[model samples]
Target: MSTPAPHAAPLVLVTGASGYIGGRLVPALLDAGFRVRAMARHADRLQDRPWRDRVEVVEADVQDPASLEAALDGVDVAYYLIHAMGGGRSFADRDRQGARSFADASARAGVGRIVYLGGIHPDGEELSTHMASRKEVGDILLAGAVPAVVLRAAVILGSGSASFEIMRHLAERLPVMIAPQWLRNRIQPIAVRDVLHYLVGAARLDGAPNRTFDVGGPDVLTFAELLQAYARAAGLPQRRILTVPVLTPRLASHWIGLVTPVPTGIARPLVESLIHESVAAEADLRALIPAPEGGLTSVDRAIELALARVRELDVATAWHSATPAGAPSSPLPEDPEWSGGIVRGDERQRPVDASPETLWAVLEGIGGRRGWYSWRLGWISRGLMDRLVGGPGLRRGRRHPDKLAVGDALDWWRVERLERGRLLRLRAEMRVPGQAWLELGVQEADDGGSILHQRAIYHPHGLLGDLYWWAVWPFHEIVFGGMQRNIARAAEAAPPDSRRAVNTDTDTDTDTEETA
Candidate 1:
C-alpha cells in the first residue's frame, strides 16, 4: 500500500523558539519543508541562528494573549514548547496560567491543531510537582476548541538540556558521591534527536488528535547506572556512589547548585521531579514510526557525539579567541572579580590518583584534535561569522601533538607560557571589543595526584564588550565545564607515560647502592 505525501507544508508557529529544544525544532521544521513563524520575547536573541532570515520572527510573550493574535494569524499549526523552568518558587502556577492563556488565544485564532511536548508520568504513581504541572498544562491545552496532540517523554539527554547538565556536573565534580534515594529511580532517557523526530512526525500525523503518547528510549536504566555510564564515556574514574535516604529534594538541589552552574531557581523543581520512575508505559509510538531509526541512542555513542560536537565548536573558532589566555600581554591590569569583562575564573579541587604529567597530556590535547564541550554547530557558525568579520576562522591547529610551548598557537590562542606539568597560558588573537585569555595551572598533590585550575578571562572594551560577554555566558558555561571534565576524565583513563621514568630511576638507585 502506498501512502500519499501531504500537499503543502503548514505555516507552523513555534513558541519557546529561543529555548534548547525550540532552537533545534524550528530549524528541523524548516528543513522538512514547513514554513515556520517563530515567537520569542526578544527577536535579537534569535539573530545568531542561520535560519533567522528564513523564518518570520515575531516578538511576543505567550502570557500576553493580545500580542499572540498577530503571531497566530496565518499559522496552520502551533507548537507550545515554553516552560517556566527559571521562574522562582511558583513556576508551576506561572506555567499553568501561561498555557491557559496561550490555549485560549490559539483556539480563538482558529488554529487547526496544537502540538505539545510534556513529561512522562506513571499511571498510578504519585507525580512530582514538575510532572504534575506539565500534565496540568496538557489538560488545559486539550480543553480548548482545537485538537491537541500531546507527547510525553522522560529525561531528554542533549548538550544544553537541564537534566543532562545536572547529571554531567555531578559526575564531574563528585568523585565519591553520597546521593539521595531518588538516585536509584529508574528512567528511560531519550536523545534530543529522537524527541525531535516524534515531534516532527506529529506535524502531519494522519488521524491522531487529542491523544497522548508516552515516548521514551528503548533502554531503561537506574539513575546510578546512567551516571556511571556518563562517567565512563567522559573518561572519569569509577566513582564510589552511595545513596542515603536522609537528603531531601531541597537539600539535594542546593548541593547540585554548589557543584554545577545550575541555579536553585531551576534545579529545585527538576530535583523534586527526580523521585518518579519516568519510563514509557506504551510502545505505540514505535508502531507509528519505524523501530531502529526512532529508537534511543546507546549511552556511549550519545556522549561521544555530544563531546565531538563541542570540540568542533572550539576548533571552528580557532584564531577567534573569546578571552585572552593567561595574564595580560600589556600593562592594562586584570579584573579581580568576574565582572562583565571577558576573563572568568573558577577553582575546585578533587582528590584523584593521577600524576601531573598525565594531566598535562590531557590539557595539550584540547584544541585542534579535541572537540568543544557542547553545541558544535552553534560554535562553527559563530566562528565562521567571526572569521568573516576579518577574524581567524578554523585555520589554527596546534603545532605538535602532546607538546606545547610559550607563544605556540593552539587554535586562536598563542601559548603565552608553558611550565611542564605545572602551568599553561594562551593569548587571544581574535578581534573582539575587548581582550581575552585562558589559563590552566596544576598543582601536584602530596599523594601523587594533581589539582587542575582552568580559567577564562576577558577585558571588555565598554558596554558592547559587556553585552557580548554576558550574551555568550550560557555557551561559555557549557563549553568550559565540559572541557574541565574531559581533562579530568582523560587523565584518569590513561596511565601517565612518566611512570616508566620513575621505575627506571628506582632501578638506577638500587644499582648505585650495590656498587658502593
Candidate 2:
C-alpha cells in the first residue's frame, strides 16, 4: 500500500499504540484511508493485531526525549494519546513529563498538528489525580509549538475499557451493591466508536484550531443509572445499589478490587473521578467531527456493545493493564533478572505455510481480546485465582487488539519481548511461587513455510514455587500445546488479503462472554 498524499490523509502518528484508545484508533484511521505510523515503547506489543502489518510500528518512549525525534519525523499530525493513568500516584508527574516532551518534540519535528483525547469535568470542581493528570496532558499538548486539538470526554464506554469494566463487573457480580456515594454524581458517557470518529475526523479538519472541545453522547446519566441500564441490556434482573456515604474513594477502590477485576491503583482514581459532574461543557463538537448517522449512543446501546465485546473476548484488544505503567519502557527483557535459581519449562516448535507476518500476528494477539486461542476456561480460572491472591490477573488485558508492546499487561503476563516477525515472549505476572515466562515465535522455514515455537519457563522461588510448577506442568500440554496449534491453524486459515482492508465504515466490537 502507498502512503496518502499530505493533503489527502495526513501521515498520522498514534502514540500509546499499545493502549486501549490507541489500539482501536489505528484501525479507524486505516479504514478512513490514512497511512499510519504507530509508536509504542515496544513495537512487539502490537505484533498480534489483524492489521499488524498494515501500519508502521516504531519503538519510541515519550519520556525519553531523545527517542521522539525519529518517531515524530515527517509526521503530519501526531495523536498525543499517551497518559499515565496506569502509572499510579506519580502518574501526574510522568504524564506532565511525557506530554511536555511530546509537545516539544512535535514542534521540533515540523509536525503540522497534534490531537489528544483528554478528560472532561465541570469547572470549579476539584479533580481527582486521574482527571488532573489527564487534563494536564491536554494542557501541555494544547500549548504545543504546533497547533493542537484536544477532545475531552467523560466515562468512555467500550467492552474492554477500564471505566466500562468497573460498572460491568459490579453489575454482573453483585445483585446488591454497596457502592460509593459518588455513583449518584452525573456523567455523560460516550461510546468508543464516537470517540474514534471524532479522532479520525480531526485529521481532515482544515487549519490550526489549536483549541479544546468537549464531546459526549446525548444522554446524561448518573453512574448508578448507567449500571442499571447495563444490567437491563445484559438481561440481568434489576440490581439493588446501596450508596454508603462513608466509603471514601480509597475504601471504595479496595471494595472494588475485592469484587471486580479492576486493580486498586486503577479503581481508586476512577472512583475519585466520579465525585463530580462530568457533562460536556459544550455541544459544538458536532460541527468539527460531525455526529454519526444514527446520532450518539445511549447508555443501553453502549452497554450492549461493551457487553458483546466482553462476551466475545475482544475486550482485551480494547483495554490495558490496571497496574501503574511504571514498567521499564523496554517491552521484552533480553534476559531474565539473573538470580541464582532453579528453572523448569516446556518447549516445542511447529511449521506453518503462511508468511512470517501472518504467524507473528497470531502469536502477537494471543491474550486479552483474542484469548489464549485454546483452553481459555483454564486461562480464566487461573486469572481468577491470581486476582484472589492479589496478582495482576486477566482483567488487566492488553492495550490493543493486535499490538503487543513492552510493558503491556496480558492475562497474567506482561509482554517481555516482541522481535517483530521473529519472536514474542511474555513474562507471567499472575501470583505464582515462581517467576514464569511464556515465549512464542515464528521464523522462515527452509521450504518457504514458517517455524512456530512455544515455551513456558519457570524459576521456582522455593519449595512452594517448585510445587506450583509441578502442579501446573500437566495442564501445559493441554493449554500451551493447544494454544500453539490453534494459533498456527488460525494464521494459516486466514486469507492473505483479509488484513488489507480496514473496516472503518462502521465501528463495532464483537467479543465473547468473559469468564466469571
Candidate 3:
C-alpha cells in the first residue's frame, strides 16, 4: 500500500478544547492529520486528555478581544465551541460577549472559515435564555467576514457530558418521575460521537459560508419518552413519568437539581431549552458526512457509551488521600505539612508460631524485590500506580534487612513503630479515599511457638469513600488474606533457633489470627 502524502491539512484552532464537546473533538482532528491549535483558559486542566500532546496549546479567553488576536493568529479554521453554562446569572451575556470577540478576531485574522456548535430549537417558537444565547452566538459568528458553518445540536448524550449526567442521575435515583409540561416537549438528542463527526467533517468542507444546520440523532422522542428509554437501557423497571402542564421551567430546574448530580445553575438552562422541540430540520449534516459517519446513534447506544466513559474515568483515576497529624500522609512523605484528615487507633492482629527475628524478616521483605508470596503481582501493580500519582512505589525498600525502626519507609508505607521482635506498626503512606494501617505484633506463647498477629484497617471519607471501600473489599480480602498467610509461612520457613528464641530471653509459643 502506498502511503498517502501528508498535505497541509490546515491549522485548525479549537476553542474550549478543555470542555466536554471540544474535549472529544481534538483527537478526531489529530487522527485526520490536521494541525491543531487547542485553546483553553487553563491548559493544565486538559493535560490528561488523549490529544493533549498532539496540538499546540494557546491560552486565551474568548471574552477577551485582545486574547483572541493571539489565539487566532496563523489559524486557517477555528472551532467556536465555548459556552458558559456553569457560571451564574449573566451566562447568556458572557456567551454573547465571547462569541462577538471571537467573531471580530477571526475576521481580523483573515481566517478562511469558522465552525461553531450551537443549541437547536424549532423555528418560530419562543426560546429560553440558554437557547437564545446559543442563537445569538451563531448570529455573532455569522457576522464575521470569514465564512462560518454553525451546526446547532440539542441535548448531547455522552458520559461526563451535562445532559447525560442529568439523565443518569434521574434514572439512577428516581423510580417514579412527576414531570412538568416540558417533559412532553419533544427533543432530538445527539450522540456526542456523532456530533464530533459532523464537527470534524465541517472543518474540511470546501463550500458554504455563514450556513446553519440543525443536528441531532434519529430518535425524536419526548423528554418523558427519552427518560423511559434511558431507564430501560439501564435495566431498570419501566419508570412511570406523569406529565403535569402546571409546573413551570423555573420549578423544573429546581426539581432537576434535587434529582440529578447537575447543579441548579446548569440544569436551569437545560430545562429552559427543553421548552421547544429540537429535532433536526435540515438533512445537510447527514449529506456532508455519509452513512456510518452520518448515521445518528440510537439513544440507548449513546446512553451506554456515555455511562461507560464516566465509569472508566472514575475507576482509573485516584483522588489523593488527605494528610494526618500535621504531617503530610502522602506516599512521598517528605514534609509533615499535612493537608488531609487524620486516622487513629484502627488496628487488627494475628499470631504465628515463629520467633521475632523470623517474623520481622518476613515483614521487612514483604514486597518489592521480594514477592508478596501470593497475589503479589496485584499488589505491585497497584503500588506502581500509587507511585505514579506521587505515591510511594515499590522502589523504596525496607530500612534494615530484617529489622524495622520507627518512621522507616517500607514500600508505600512507613514503619510508625517497632519493638524489637515483638511488634511492628505501619502507617500507610499510599493515597487512598481514607486512612489505612497495617500492624504486626508477636509475643511468646505458652506452647513454645510465638504468637504472630497481622491486621489492616481503613477509615472511609464520605459517600464516595464508602463506595470505594466496598468496591475494593473483594480485592482487599484476597490480598490481605494472602499477606497474612505468607507471613506465617515465612516465619515457619526460618531456622528453629530463630522461632524458639525471641530476643534470646523469650520462650513459649502459640498462634492466633484475627481480622476486621
The most accurate candidate by TM-score is 2
Backbone N/Cα/C clashes per model? 20, 24, 15
lDDT by candidate, in order shown: 0.67, 0.76, 0.67
Q: Which regions of candidate 2 are displaced past 4 Å?
A: 1-8, 313-316, 321-324, 328-390, 394-410, 415-424, 431-435, 439-516
Q: Which numbered prediction scores highest in lDDT against the true structure?
A: 2
Task: Judge candidate 1 against the unseen true structure and give its global Cα lDDT, from 0 to 1.
Answer: 0.67
lDDT of 2 by residue, 26-121 (tens): 999999998899998777667766678999889898889999988988888899887665465677888899889998988888888899998787
Candidate 1: where is the Cα deviation over 4 Å?
1-8, 291-295, 314-516
lDDT of 3: 0.67
What TM-score does candidate 3 get on C-alpha atoms?
0.61
lDDT of 3 by residue, 417-440 (tens): 566566666777666877677777
Query: Which is better, 2 or 3, measured by TM-score?
Result: 2
Task: Give the winner by TM-score: 1 or 2.
Answer: 2
Q: Write the per-residue lDDT of candidate 1 for residues 77-134, one digit (tens) a residue.
A: 8999877664445778878888888888887888878999999887777777777888
Instruction: Tell me the alpha-carbon RMSD of every candidate.
Output: 16.2, 7.5, 15.2
